[model samples]
Target: MTGSSHPVIDVRDVSKSVNGPEGRLDILSDVAMQVNGGESFAIVGASGSGKTTLLGLLAGLDTPTRGSIQLDGHALEQLDEEARADLRRRLVGFVFQSFHLLPALTAEQNVMLPLELEGNRAAREKARTALEAVGLGPRRSYYPAQLSGGEQQRVAIARAFVHSPRVLFADEPTGNLDRRTGRHVCDLLFALNRDHGTTLVLVTHDLPLAERCARCVQLQEGRLEPLA
Candidate 1:
């Protein structure tokens, strides 16, 4: 599988369950999916349908309770936390719905973090370029609080792309913006995908956004169904 160069992500019979107050709760079950390199994919479903959980597993942020997940040829379940973190740093980038920016860091600093962690000497310059790419260059010095909701989200997008990761995971990226703003953000996201040929796995409720991807999978009652 490693020698072959087809799939970037492969999940086989994956399931996730958690211990709840009532008992065990199954969040996802028997989910199998694959996304090829340089492909754009989407997971669309209603709230509590395990879309985010699937994204986390794909990104190696969380381990599935059952089955195997191979991300970029590495087995996620076999990696320790430190190894997973290292892999994420090296190969994965994430954009959260909440825009999880460090309050103490300005937009530039936030975008620079990943590059700095990777020991890149041009962190500041690369960060600046990413911000400029997202049309937030003028607000590079501003903290998250100083920016509008849309501006803050733009910063997050910049941060996610600054490292030029092999794969990008976005969970409800446009959830916080108005319709027009969301459309703009979506366009920017796809533009980045086009420019970099990055593999994209997005969990979104936006039908148009989902339709833009090469493939779309839907979650219903913790099970995956093909969206035709």
Candidate 2:
């Protein structure tokens, strides 16, 4: 799927607002972007700059107030909640700064969760391979509490890509780690993105991290701004 002609994500005239105590609060205003298949695109902004809000919309976790989003060629606003969730299950993967692994599950079990949800019979085997890819094969039996921050994030990354999603959304993936460990995670992410030909949509406040992407767009006080 290298150099794919079709866009995996397309956003047009999108605006998102929420009712606040003061009045209406706009989180995004008429944002438009097209992320081509297999492209690495970054949504970079400062804290409270609506980066996460836009990521959620792109991933179909939430809907925009005034426009359409096409994810993997499906109109997200046209899908109901369950249909949108199903779409996410089929096409989207995510990594968060908090390392959202289940506390009670072992690394292997955590990695297997997505496959198991889809009733995959080879969940265990696939999870083992994913963990091995992340250099955590030997720690498959360890719980999240037993692993260091870096190891936990590694597990999260493995779990994210285990089902082989079309788009991988990462929100400040390195925010919780030290500089050295963060670099390792970044390398792993890009390697997987390359090998899998997966569309990477990264949201981060760190300019250096955002710079790694092929293209980048910044959000400023809820408006889209081109980054030089």
Find the candidate with the highest lDDT and give its number.
2
TM-score of 1: 0.95
Q: Note the Cα lDDT for every prediction shown.
A: 0.91, 0.94
Lowest lDDT 10-residue stretch of candidate 2? 1-10
Q: Highest TM-score, which number?
A: 2
lDDT (10s digit) by residue, model 2, range 136-167: 99999999999999999999999999999999
Local accuracy of candidate 1 as per-residue lDDT tens digits, 75-171 = 9999999999999998988998899999999999999998988899999999999999999999999999999888988899999989888899999
Clash pairs (backbone) in predicted model 1: none
Q: Give the per-residue Cα lDDT of candidate 1 at 151.
A: 90
Candidate 2: list runs displaced more than 4 Å.
Answer: none
